[model samples]
Target: MALDFTTTQWITIGAGAIVSWLLLKWITSPSPKKFTVKVPEAADPKWTGKVLENPSIRDPSNPSTIVCYDPSTGYLIDTVPNPTVEEVKELYNRTAAAQVKWAKTTFEQRRTVLRSLLAFVLENQETICRVDCRDTGKTMIDASLGEIITTCAKLRWTIDNGESVLADDYRAPGLMMMYKHSKVVYQPLGVVSALVSWNYPFHNAIGPVISALMSGNGIIVKCSEYVAWSSKYYEQIIKTCLSVNGFDPDLVQFVPGFADVGEAVVQSGVNHVTFIGSPAVGKLVQRNASDYLVPCVLELGGKDCAILLKDSDLVQAIPVLMRGVFQNCGQNCIGIERIIVAAEIYEKVVEEMNTRIGKLRQGSILAEGEGVDCGAMTMGNQFEKLEALVQDAVSHGARLLRGGKRYHHPKHPSGQYFEPTLLADVTPEMDIANIEAFAPIMVIMKHQGPEDAVRIANLCPFGLGSSVFSADKKLAEKMCMQLKTGMANVNDFAVNYLCQGLPFGGVGISGYGRFSGKEGLRGLCVPKAFTTDRIPGVKTPIPPILDYPVQSAKKGWSFVSALNNLVYNPEVPAKVGACVDLAKANI
Candidate 1:
């Protein structure tokens, strides 16, 4: 057989082949080179050890400035301006105005902005981690895992999948409306607001910004006053990224203040709000957003649990358990606050964990070498509450295996440090078992069986993330299904969050709505449903029998009933009778 092609057709085929090859290479290429950042032997020489015990305190002289300092080394970081409520409103207005123009930009333009941010993060991963460590009192390793890596994953996922997620979705019009076309067009929702906590300052600040800009909306981030120092630096990074990408930097804004500022942001007339904080504060945000009838997504506190069955692999599970409890100085919302161990291995697990906890060296990460296993807590005010909870638990027959109180670090007495704690024989009746002890305390409860384990795990009001470990895959899966949480893992812990495609959120006191993944990106936009004629000349016209004049009301009713039956009836006889009746009614 012989085939011939025109020159134009050959050129088109060649161009398509080249494009396909280039796209394949782009998708399969390895990620940017990951640099190994070394922990500094000492704090930054610029740190003057001038501690501001309360960063939220307004400078009496200036009244408009917040005293920001390092929680770890007690070093004076810097002072950030505390914007007034009126300033917050004005900031939101400017952001909304810029969003009007941004919403008109193409997906490619948005991708460029995200790519610039991704590149900035990759190039300055060390600097980002250092800033986060300074502000949050977390170790460099913790910052790498919680701040740098998570932010990069989110940026990468959004850049690759955001356009498709926001694209118009064509839907079937059904048989009766076959001549019509229907679709859901995702459109921008103007300005959105996020009130983020200080734990993962960099990640929290950048996360909402990425989603909002990708969905063609502006964002105003209300950062915690505790991390105001780092928030100022992050705000500069975002603005610089936007400006260099030829975007209006006003499209994104960061407001750093106390409760009044957060309340102002929620009621700032933004189209939507996302809040990440305590359950107490989340309720306030919801109430304030209700004033404008604006929708909100709240990611609140959690008492995440890990259940270890008798047959579970201790070698593999112990490391995961350690990381899950001690990560981010146990300030993680999803960190395992409770551990349910089978009675058979309960004592062994306690012994193993206690030995590990004894060796954990805690100090200010910024003060010395990388030998420290855990860093200082972000806030010292919570120490009293945490101690009270532990003491209450001890009073209730819980065995305090090790570290029952706060530890004053020998090297840095000013720093907030809590000993890595291991408390065994924890019962549901104990206050510590039911409350969200967001600290380094590891509470272990004995479970006779899977049912008892689940009961203990679900005792807390929070229903966030959970983990079930067992050698039997079937049993593990079954128990995981029974756990009362938004997300669960079998033989794993917190791996769901590492996979960026999965939505992250919870139920009950943990709060409602989802963030991350496709659900999150779409949630930021309005799903506008629209329909039009499928063919150029095809149209729907009002029938004479059912016209507004209603010359024959009885006939109009009969006509509608027959039409519905003809389209919906499954039996041939019924459809035939309906057709006949429709004809008679029309006449």
Candidate 2:
């Protein structure tokens, strides 16, 4: 029934098909431009230590609100509402209600919201970084690297591959069930919650939200009270994106308060919870989530280790070592806390670390300028603990090569600053070597060989991330395999986080379950197995031999055994025998 066409008509049809194909490609392709953030060279001096007369005041006039301030200089930021348990419950209710409608939306609609958010983040990169710096006291460069780049990468990844990850995954039916069709459908959980950390405020808050929305679940983020100032801005950005995209703004909520509020979030009848913070608090979250029988994905702290083999390239490894220890003032959960160096290159590594660490200026980067390499600590009280750890190590025969105490900033005397520290000859016995030091202190331990390096690296109770540096690729990979960490890099440090496709989480005290990659995106959903008939008018049926009123139990067993052998037996003679046995059993 084919119709013959003229040459001109055929050419016209081909031209139309080409145009449609081109249009579809253009529509589907992601934006080609790479998002960039401009790191400021200097900050205004006035902003450095501009504190209110009563900077520590917690807004006594208004009990409903909690005061927020810059931990670096005690500068007062705006106060935000502190939600009560009842308020937290209300938030969950609202989000859950919105999710009911949102779950019905098409993938195109979810992508539209993400595209809008991507545009907003790019246009307001400076504002976003500034808000994070103001609240967390991190440097502009740190904010650009940790906040801007990671958030953009997450948004882009989710937008590009989220639909495919959440698509119905078909499974092959075995020979015994050839007439059956099976698939796993990823359906959204009504509501999900994330109790994120305060280190990278922007990324921590936005990351779970991205997964929640992409998978069609509403999320309530319980942010760290330490970064409540910036959480408000992030909340606005997320809600505005949702509102503009015609989705209910209540679909995304941010709760900022004390521990009680966080407890409420976990016990608020949410379908799932994603918690990122210290190990101590993670236990509490697990306990509370247990009451409701709610499942949780906990991404807790890590005492990550970096091993430097004798054959490692010092030229390339030195910079990575410095950044791994000092980035975000070493507040990173997966930051390299201990450096295990081969005995051959132990002295060289220590000397290089000492020289570079001595030159690093510590101050309030937001108020100062490019002169400062390391910024202030968010938790000033941790200074006492850090000093105690360092003193303990030094007393145990560990040598303090450089700064190991708190740095008193001349310009901003009240600012919270820890000196960039270098501790050499650290042993596995010292507390500093085993404990998680979320500060700008580099601890180096000498290892006799590859086995010793791995032994020292795995000594810590926490096993989140690890790195092995060696010129010999095979040796490095072998060492990485032996390291007891969730994620290990052969020649780099913490670069696994940049590749959004890989699952990001850890084993042991680092907590359980993942919150990134396909595992994470689908973690927010319920994977339900679906089955139906592959052919029309064909279906599964109960055989009389296996029915409720079986006349003879031995005959029924023989019938089932013969059927199994006929379908699965490898030998042709065995299969033929089984078929004959099956015929006799049926008769």
Candidate 3:
């Protein structure tokens, strides 16, 4: 028998259809976007009709795309002088030639010249700051003092600390009448290629260069096209300043190049390559390294998480979370991209997050210290990509609790700025939270409990940095252990690892080799050993057994020394006292 639909069942089906249609309409509705216009110069404004007008592109064969900007109008300035491939090659050859002499110079000689260069950098802070602001769209306040100042500090620190890594370690004279010996020391490699990013141009370039150079290696630095001029010419200015101070200008050379040049620079049979960029390009560098079998340090992308559980202080967690996501317009590799909130505090956290996001005041790039909340993205295409991600998430059922739109001033239509935006109801299932949005947007995800938060946080393919906000010490400890990330902050996001003298590297898709801190410094070189010998009847303790038969009279002393040293220094002995001291300690 066939079943027939009842009147109540038919009415229920009709109601379901109406509800589904209404839901579809709500999802497709156009969310309104607002903007505030900003004009730089009303007195006199000049528009350059060329995107490649940066003077650096002047060379025909070794052409470059200029990154010039008019500060008054936030307009892409004009063409300047681009360092051609020829210029890049010339710089490479110079560095290659000078590296031979530089590597051979005594540690003190290198140290002296490095110090002089640091001094030169200090003297040119003003000009460097202006160039940084114009080239990359970062305010001078951030670039010069923030980026350059930190770069200078790292330069001096790397120079000073580098010696310790290369310091010649000697093994004490061993037992065969000082005839046998072993040695350990730090040896320098040939030229190294440093491929840097634009976010923190100066610091990004200086850190790797300092480490590689201090290890007695020649280096070629490839800057992001966004700020290639800044990175390439910095060394020249320092060299010019140092010439008067009489530092060896030849020891360091900076060259500007494109992606092709970057590829060529890394593939040119260099000793090592240290790269800080996206994983795709990093992989390219790593593959390039395979040809020559050279080692590389690749710092890539990260989808870091920030967890806010019950009882967490909204005041503290709120600002830190915003900073973790919004710093440098949310372009940081280790910046917070995911916010996992515990159900108990989910609504409260969302309310507070919306308040903070709402307070953001978008403004021109030149707003040095303006109360303005954020600046334009340095990379224009990045803005469009970020917009698409937000729209996709909205279309896929994620509801925007706040800031789901972009604002533009009609007058300055060409301005690259985007509004500070936040989205709530983001689920792990949504691509919005899974992939990285390298822009000024933040996403908040809800969780049933701490277990769910941890599960979702660890779900991403990335494992760069993570944070847990809990008054409970045990929970914080446990979460840090469970998460598969390189660095985790208990009450904070990342800002913790910056220049704190700690090693920082990602675990999963982040990258391969480590840099910064002990592991980083050590990664720049290989360890070597040194050995020496001492004679028989040398009161070598005779294994603390005077009656023991000798393997060989000549070899007897070595055997005894090895046995005695085992009781004392498991390595090699520096002094009788050291041996005796180590023996008692180890024994």
The Cα error of candidate 1 at residue 219, in Å, is 0.5
lDDT of 1 at 97: 89
TM-score of each: 0.92, 0.92, 0.75
lDDT of each: 0.87, 0.87, 0.68
Q: Which stretches of candidate 3 lie over 4 Å from their true place?
A: 1-64, 70-74, 80-87, 114-127, 140-146, 169-183, 241-245, 365-369, 404-406, 534-587
List per-candidate RMSD values in Å.
5.7, 6.1, 19.5
TM-score of 1: 0.92
| Candidate 1: C-alpha lDDT | 0.87
Which clashing pairs does model 1 show? none
Better of 1 and 3 by TM-score: 1
Worst 10 residues of 2 by lDDT: 34-43
Could you tally the backbone clashes for each prediction? 0, 1, 33
Off by over 4 Å in 2: 1-65
**For residues 40-91, could you state the per-residue lDDT of candidate 3 as single tens digits?**
1211212233333222323466355555453212554544454555666677
Candidate 1 lDDT, tens digit per residue, 477-513?
9988888898899888888887778899998899999
Ranking by lDDT: 1, 2, 3
lDDT of 2 by residue, 234-332 (tens): 898888788866789999999887788889998888999999988999999999999999999988889899999999999999999899999999999
